[model samples]
Target: MSRFKRGAHVDSRAGFRQEKEDCPVPYGLLKAARKSGQLKSIRAVLMYLGSVPHSVWRLNIDTPQEAQQNLSFGAADLTKLLLSSNKLQSLSEDVKLLPSLVVLDIHDNQLSSLPDSIRDLEQLQKLILSHNKLTQLPSGLWRLTNLRCLHLQQNLIEQIPQDSGQLVHLDDLDLSNNHLMDIPESLANLKNLVALNLSCNKLKSLPPAISEMKNLRMLDCSRNQIESIPPVLAQMESLEQLYLRHNKLRFLPELHCCKTLKELHCGNNQIEVLEADHLKHLSALSFLALRDNKVKNLPEEITLLQGLEHLDLTNNDISSLPCGLGTLPKLKSLALEGNPLRTIRRDLLTKGTGELLKYLRSRIQEEPKTAMTLPSQAKINVHAIKTLKTLDYSEMNKTHQDKSMTTNRGCCRKATKMEEILLGESFLSFDLCKYRMLAFIKIKRGLFRFP
Candidate 1:
């Protein structure tokens, strides 16, 4: 017989016995046997060791009976514990028994508060309590300096303790979907933070100290009642993605230092002007959204964005566009719908972005060069005057003294008719002798004086 078959009838309280149906093996002896390598068969070893201390533990004890039966294990060796999607109204103080615990996830529960004994877990690194009914965080949470990720989103958190910045090593934080109206200034102490989400809140403004997060890459403060953003936002050199949609801002902040920014979403606001100073520094921008604003004109400097791919300007008051907009090479998605554009035909817009861009380029080519045009009523013609060699007033029937004062009366008669057709009959009564003397003196000298 196999060793597993021999140990099948072992009792729980007794040591390994011979031919006994009621007596079972002791737990301590089975453990010792497994430790000394006496248990050779894998089946026998599994049958002997049913539940033991592991580095990771997960339990779904929603009922009272299941909680009492399943949660009674020794957690001295546990490093991670997940009890999500349960009816856990509260956590027991016994959680402090797990000294080596590093991660605890109890999201999607009815947890309203955490026990103060949670501070005893000195090695805890991540605490995920999102989608809970937590109204306030315990004061002991700040003691977890080693914590790197803390998610308290979708909760009823009304305020964050000022000392919350004690978690200096935290990298990712999500406090969205809360009722917070303000934040603590000490939050700037989290120098290692990378991503911060404070969206879907009632915040009116952000602390000025928030600009101190030098390593931050992404920031989402959308869907709030914020009236203005701090100018210090331009100082975040490492910021790549910024979201400020659905706010009450009246203008865009000058982003002269945000050179690494890639995506900026500031749609659904009350912005009226987009100046050159607001766009000159965003050299690395790719996506810009300014939909549903009151902007009337886009500055000619907008073509400076060489890498821009998507530009959304729907429902604006813009009536014209700069011709340079057609020269951008990388623009692929341009949304000008719901605008009051009068120059571009509606049919052309319906044809899509390609046709619209082609039309703008054609307009650039069709524009005429700078030149002064004369009216049709003016019969004066100056094209025949090859260098102003003669000054002839035909109505007066006389010609000025030219290169050697040749008195060619017949040629002078033809010049009189041409002058009448050019200068009109208004010069008939003008004094020709005085003007002729002035012209001869001017031609003789290098300087010509205009009367």
Candidate 2:
């Protein structure tokens, strides 16, 4: 005969029955309980559903029926399931009952391994198992053919099973912060893989079979000990973005045929040379980062990359430049900080790319005689014999010289004017005439010198 502790009703707008904010309860359930004479049953059910578990169920009072009734439904069709930071040592066997799960985020758990029952979730797409103590993946996980994204980052995984290639449909795989020494050849079977992040691992070299993944667009192998890039990887047609930062690479990958490449980041490596053919083939490339490498020179052929937009050569040993580099049509952002380039102007060190280009153009134009040499040569008679060293100023005179006039007469007139200028006391120095005569004799010998 215990009376049920019925709390005050809650207002929808104000959230309390008295509008003064007291502990709120539902009015509909309380009204139904009073009419059915089950007020105590309703209160116990509400309390059990709303309260968190304090301890193991008191068997004397809490029956199996009460515990089973506490389970909440309607969370089954949820796409994202987060069970992180929980005291869960193992996933519940009942999680397999959720049929509509897509993303299973259970990071920061004490799970040493995953239950094989999870493989039954055919609709599950992304599986995040980070920060767990899993030393290996379950063999049954290879059966999830529909999985497109798998994140096993920050785990205790030391080796990838050879059967990892079974994930043919996976497009993204993140195994960063692991203890792997080599990538399994089975990974090449993931033909649809667009992004593969193996950063912060202990890998020493990449497998040649990696070129088999034709759809790979982004690859991050940063912070590893990779010493060489396999030449076979150059044939990967769809590879667009590559990250090999902080590695021990001494030379760039021979990715000459990878035309779709857009960004290549190999910063903090030991690369020494960049090939001219490498730059010429990357027609679609926009960003190139070779910062903190051992590169010494840039080939003039680098200007062939008309689509290049951002170039970062910071902290390298570069000391000069190919003069034609400034003529690149699409080059916008150029970071040359910390390099010892001798050709770059001191005043233009802090200038923008446009101003730098303008300065370069002005310099090219300042030498007008040198710049006009090609066009002047185009107008000159190549077949002319007895070539005149002096430019003809008498041609503009109104009276045309008769062809029959003797050439000796013209030579005597020119030599008489030159002799007067040379013998004058007003001359800067008398020895200058001897030097001029020797220079003219040398020029005459060179003009008639036969091979």
Candidate 3:
């Protein structure tokens, strides 16, 4: 007889024994095997029934039936045990008796602790403890070195033991939405770790030793109280996606060596300045965000980011932009909303980024150059009259008074063609006391001289 036992999947009206009109062998099968009979135990009972036709084990057992089992799955035939949502306060110690167990899911239970005998199941590879009231893990949990996936999220846990680093084979660790104040330094010992999430915590800084994780590719430390990112993070050559949003960072640390960084999200911070040298080094950076900060200007050196594809500068105080930013060849999505700049036409807001960039490019290209002409009075008259308009009498008077007082103002005015006027449509604006009389006399052949 096989030592494995499987439970029955039957409704409330399940028949235990067939009444009068049945074959004797079928009647024997309908009867529950007596403890002292051929099936002495549940395992032998399942083995004897294995020869029966059309028998399926119970998989979707409700709370009533599960409670009847009392969270006990001592049957060796049980390779997968799911006791989730059974309203059990704790797991039975008999769980360790199942030596062949491979997957165990007791999530969504009210258990605040685990049986110390859990370590006996050396074959257990996956454990789910999410939605539990566990504040700390079992001390023997690290002994399960075969664990490849562990889900401990949404718990009241406040700290992780330094011994957690013993899980060297762990490739993914999620500790989000907890009350953790800091991460253990032993975490750096997990050199094979590929993804880590530390969001929604109070971590002020990360251990500098984290740079040793050469295989780490995704890191999320957002929604923390971190004030500064250590410059050593820049040396993480394999890092690809870094999320540092919702922190108190005031400036971007020099990331000259993060050559593989592709997506950087640093929004919702106090960053106010971006150094041109720092930007020139991010050759591989594609998606950049500086939203909801106090950034005021974009350096022309940003044009050197040849691979830049998406730039988000929404909700900042940037009043103007460097003209060359529009000519970036690879730029695809550019967000400039909620800024104070009116550099682009006011009506262009509804048109979108492409239209705005094109408008700025057109504006720069069509910018009129102040025409330079001959040094003769004729050209001087046209140039001065066109450039200077509605002269400030008070300013001129103060200048003249200062000249008379300083005694060299007249000498200064004689050296420069102090002022001039020219003919134009429906306007005869002139600075009479200075260039006014000079231009008039020159055109009149010195007819009305001011000597």
Candidate 4:
């Protein structure tokens, strides 16, 4: 009963005729989709390749069937097509008709394979096909040299072709949550890549060549079976944040050259010991997460990270903390929960960082200072030794007086530098008897003279 829509002409045989601007090759695709009952639940909500001018076309296919049956893009060129979350089981090869496409995002679809003709979109720059059922990528995908961001996460993808090195312009590449066993070393050729995500995969180790990605700023290889990281990764000049959580690492590699690294997350591992040499070089580290590990103690060198703001040592075997930990000027959050601390009261830990730090400082102040006693043969200068006022030699054991006098002569006759010491506040003036005794026996040191 309703006359043909705006762009449609009445066709006696095919029932509906599209506008002349529509490509004939893609027109047959619509007819095939209609015949297969693919268009039964979806309205005529598709854009055929038109002229080469209108570049930004977004076909938001997530709408209900009541969506507009026909929408006008005004211009003809189709440069961006976003059909994300569509129930599209297959994409027609006629997609090649849109030669001007620069961004093609069909994420959240059921597409198992892409048409080889996808290579025809030479102008493509950003391609997102994440959350799909794709087991392998098409060879045509690797030839897109202009791509800057390629997201293929949350898919069943098992491998990436070596031809991926051709995307030298990629800045962000997310291949996380896939079945990838390992990455190709050729990925190092992406010298301009800034962020890379390889989480939740079946990878046991990473290619050492990954350290060659000079401009990579973020590298996430979490939730894998990686037992260790390539030591050369510490040489990446631009790397700032590294994530290796939920793995089987027995020890953290010594990152001696990662000067720009700021955040390191290596939780849930078998790391039992944190060596001072391996951790002290992260000079710029601000956030360090060592939770759920077998760590028995934290190295005192960890306090050398003067810029550190947060430290997580949860669920470890640490029984005592380094006293210097409370001296970090910028430390704001210190997490020591679930550790076997024997000295710190559990209630004091719950009192917040300010109170906990106050307690650590109180302990520092309460600690007894070890006295420094000079040996019997050491020389002493009576003038330099400020604490010596009087000493009682009359009460000395008569048997040892000769030995004591001989030892005291050697200790004072050649008076040298005296060690500064804390003196008791018992007396003020030097006793005359002490002066007399010092002049009498050459009991030469003030330490042996008796009052």
Index of the highest-lDDT prediction: 4
TM-score of each: 0.66, 0.65, 0.62, 0.68
Q: Give the lowest summed-lDDT range of ten residues in model 2.
A: 370-379
RMSD, each candidate, Å?
A: 18.3, 17.2, 19.2, 15.3
Report the CA-based lDDT of candidate 2 relative to the real structure: 0.67
The collision pairs in model 1 are: 10-24, 11-23, 11-24, 11-25, 12-24
Across 292-325, the per-residue lDDT of candidate 2 in tens digits comes to 9989999756766678898889999999766556
Ranking by TM-score: 4, 1, 2, 3
Kindly report which residue stretches of model 2 are placed more than 4 angstroms away from their true locations once superposed: 1-79, 85-87, 363-451
Candidate 3, position 397, lDDT? 26
Comparing 2 with 3 on TM-score, the higher-scoring candidate is: 2
RMSD of 2: 17.2
TM for candidate 1 is: 0.66
What local lDDT score does residue 370 receive in model 4, on the 0 to 100 scale? 30
Best of the candidates, TM-score: 4
